[model samples]
Target: MDNQKKQPKPWYKVWWFWILVIIIVLVLGGMMNDSSSSSSSSDRKPKAHKVSPFKRTYKVGQVVNYKGYKFKVNRVKYFSGNSMDTPKSGNQYVICNVTIKNDSHEKQDYNEMDFQLSANGNTTDFGEILTSGNYENNTLDSGSLDKGATVSGNLIGQAKKDAKLKLEYQPSFLDDKTINVNLN
Candidate 1:
């Protein structure tokens, strides 16, 4: 036999083996982290934000300001088949004359759905009734208000007879402060 002894392979010669080992370790570590985070997240509670603007209630025929926009509910009238676009039998239509002014410098988009009519603790949405020659002027249909501009229209909703009604006006769905107009 020769005097020379056979030496083991160098670390660089097995570089592919070491690379596979490192990849496996990293994959296992990522999987473990994902599972731990998911489990802990289920045990945590969501944080609540403080409401800042829900401190006051407004009345009808008064200018209510919210987030720099001004709103006013002038008058509320009930019509029972009196007009050509009145509600169906056993139902009545409410016409709320309203005016909205954009006092801020920026243009704000207004949605008619934001105005809800609450009667006897139940809320009803504004409805578009068939009126003579488009008698119902819906200002919110224009979409946006310019700076220092005013718009006036009638908000129509269906309700029952002699129901205690109130108009809820909020600048946006995300806003907490709502102006309630007693229309009874």
Candidate 2:
């Protein structure tokens, strides 16, 4: 039997190794696995940012700005995108249900909903018109929401890897507001 037989373990077994591993994972992950930069374009959901944009906690009478319009959220629900049942390659979306009250009070029938996405506030040339909607409200009482009426639509914005994204809503016969969204 020879005296020089086994070698010692690599540093990875110790706390220092864990530290190095964590550092490497963070740096490399941030670069590759970043929300906007991941090569896997097929993936529908990205790793969420540290803070969510929806975390603002909207309440009644609180104005929510989408695409370009500011509307009051008398009720909140999952608004289905109403996507075609046919499966398309690498196309995925989520719909947050919303029941909006027409606080404007002018007896408005919202005909069309258009979106304008911006990267770093370049509204002229940025994202696409994610959705063009034909939304109609029978009639909203001024300052009173149609409690059970459902306003359905999807937040349709393209996935841009590793960039700042903004969503704006432009309603044909409604309101408008520039939505602020941050991506990795």
Candidate 3:
């Protein structure tokens, strides 16, 4: 044996081996992080969004086919201030009854945001009327419709007493064929 102890293996001599080990460790670490990240997402509640699968090309009385659902504006009614438990001065309520029938194979969800109201060509959202206590209980409920099921509800909004009003029905945000129902 040499008087000097055998020199330790040079790092470069095992460079390829170390590189392979490092690559494996990094790959496994990334995989572990991926699983942890996905789990974290599930720990929080996801935000909700509305989606429409088609355009609005149907008239008020015509059956509007959208994303495997059929919608028809049955009728529109106007209510004066004194007619409700709460009265509003110089303003009236325009309520449109829409009949929605899901024609798809699965259930479909709907909410007040799906319907928009226009007064004298000015657009209004469901939240605007909802904030007012006058039309609180009369508004439609957001719910899911089973396949071939039908649900009818009122979409209520406030408008000027003499305003020319219309209800715009959008089945999804991506749709362009928004059906306009004249409430004049």
Candidate 4:
């Protein structure tokens, strides 16, 4: 046999070289796809979150309509309890003159207990002290309202003296929606 040397194969023709080229092509294609997708997303405006329609606040004297019933807070008054009944120390009575109109075709039940007073981080519900005060005649009572009928009365609760208060009315026990009236 003659003494002959064989030449090595070129880098592009090697098996490992072709495998590395395929990997690089795949990585570059993935990078390009990611960049294009990000650019497209950045071109569109962001979506806005929706707000609930049932959640709302109203000022005094504004009519709040809920489930075909119309409610209006005519006035707010503060008082010191009478001799027969007195509030706790550093507390006073908050009274709201509210009018409710049944505009629906059917009769609706209403109660003074539906109203609440929130002040100084405390919530006050209708209590016995409210009925014993000098304003007893003005207090609201539980009754059924017929269509086209209107009933106006006072809702009372005890709160801190001179504290800013919010009168809240919840029409139904099962519903979380409330109508808030600010009493400054």
After TM-score superposition, what is the CA distance of residue 57 in candidate 2 from its true location, in Å? 15
Ranking by lDDT: 4, 1, 3, 2
List, residue by residue over 86-132, the lDDT tens digit for candidate 4.
Answer: 88899877788899999999999899888888896577786544556
Cα miss at 55, model 1 (Å)? Answer: 3.5
Q: Write the per-residue lDDT of candidate 2 for residues 30-53, one digit (tens) a residue.
A: 877676555566376766564322
Across residues 114-144, which tens digit of lDDT does each residue of candidate 1 receive? 8989888788887656455434545345468
lDDT at 176, model 2: 44
The segments of candidate 1 whose C-alpha lies over 4 angstroms from its true place after superposition are 1-53, 82-89, 137-142, 175-177
What residue pairs are clashing in model 3?
52-172, 55-177, 56-177, 56-178
Candidate 4, position 122, lDDT: 77
Expressed as tens digits, the lDDT of each residue in 1-184 for candidate 3 is 6698878888767778889989999999999999999888877857575443243344457677766877788777776645333325677777777888999999999887988888888988745344444456566778999998988877877888888787787766885667676667
TM-score for predicted model 4 compared with the true structure = 0.66
lDDT of residue 58 for candidate 3: 43
TM-score of each: 0.63, 0.30, 0.57, 0.66
Clash counts for the predictions, in order: 0, 20, 4, 0
Question: What is the lDDT, from 0 to 100, of the residue 169 in candidate 4?
Answer: 83
- CA shift at 65, candidate 3, in angstroms? 1.2
Assess candidate 4 and give its lDDT. 0.82
